[model samples]
Target: MSLDFVNTYSQLINLSADADPSTFYSTEDYRKLQTLGPSLPTLSYPFPSAEANLVGESTIDVKLKSIRPPFKFTTELKAIPGSLSIYKLKNQLIDEVVSLKEAGICASNLKFMIKSKILTDTTTIGLLGDEVSITVMITQPSHNDTSKLLSDPEPELEAPKSISKGAWDKIESVLSADLGPEAAKIAVSKFKQVSI
Candidate 1:
């Protein structure tokens, strides 16, 4: 027979509401299973070996270069299965990098590039090469995204100034010919008329 436990101890409804929302009980349960802490006592299993599931596919050494804010690091060669997609690789990286996991960086926020060519999530490991350097830019994460804002955006009090105004003033402005006699003057006269 399945055991059905009922709340017997009398507790005020207001007490639960004040502590957290209705989902608090469920969320707290999952918190113990979160792999980030790998949640203590519930140790996470080691990542699968890179050699798994190889048929004709070849493995590659990926050198991750975190180039953007929130986190930046030297290129580190990480091992992975050739069949792993950029999508899966991102999650794998998150699992491996403490800073990335702490920052709550997700796959969508990561922009990957190689030789100036942008890489999509569908991109696979073996397709890159036996060795490759992939640059990453993080969009930033906040509680699974706890990174806080250092400051607010500066408010603009005035419209942006344009530099093209002087060049567009064809009546003897900077764009007009001056020192060289060969080039005709656009305005024909440099003299300024004083207003009375």
Candidate 2:
């Protein structure tokens, strides 16, 4: 059975676009996407065998470590049995991240990292099973930057000088093409009210 891996990966892009960082983190799907295995070691045995072996945990602490603005995390997208070209998938992710950054919809203080790497038959056993995959990471800016980001006023968009019949028609047509017809109609109505 062939699965549409491109569509699956596309959903990730959509998720980023539709949901903010906090909202995304709150979802069950995001919880499942967390890095597997205990990053910190416990005194418990590493194996379930009769002999108990105590392992020393890493002394390095994350809190003590300085995390700069743009904290980053990586996620891997595995290709389906009959998926599109790996390059296409990689490009889609890059484009989506770029779009999100350009739209300023990422978050108040956070920046989306747009780096991606393609892997095939590598040692890295991505979140999914062995398959052609793309590993992408996005950066989460530091909490300290939030206040500054929120303090800044959003730049105002330039309103049209006058919405003539021809201009209105053009606006509606462009909106309809970009968004759906229903959204375009509502937006045009709103724009008209604002211009008045």
Candidate 1: residue pairs that collide: 35-38, 142-145, 142-146, 143-146
Choose the strongest candidate by TM-score. Answer: 1
- Per-residue CA lDDT of model 2 for 109-163, tens digit only, reads 3322212332332222222333332333334433355667789968989876776
Tens-place lDDT per residue, model 1, 113-153, is: 89878899998888888887888888865443123333554
Reference-based lDDT, each prediction: 0.64, 0.45
TM-score of each: 0.43, 0.19
- Candidate 1: which stretches are off by over 4 Å? 1-56, 75-77, 142-196
| C-alpha RMSD of each candidate structure in angstroms | 20.3, 24.5
Which residue pairs come into collision in candidate 2? 113-139
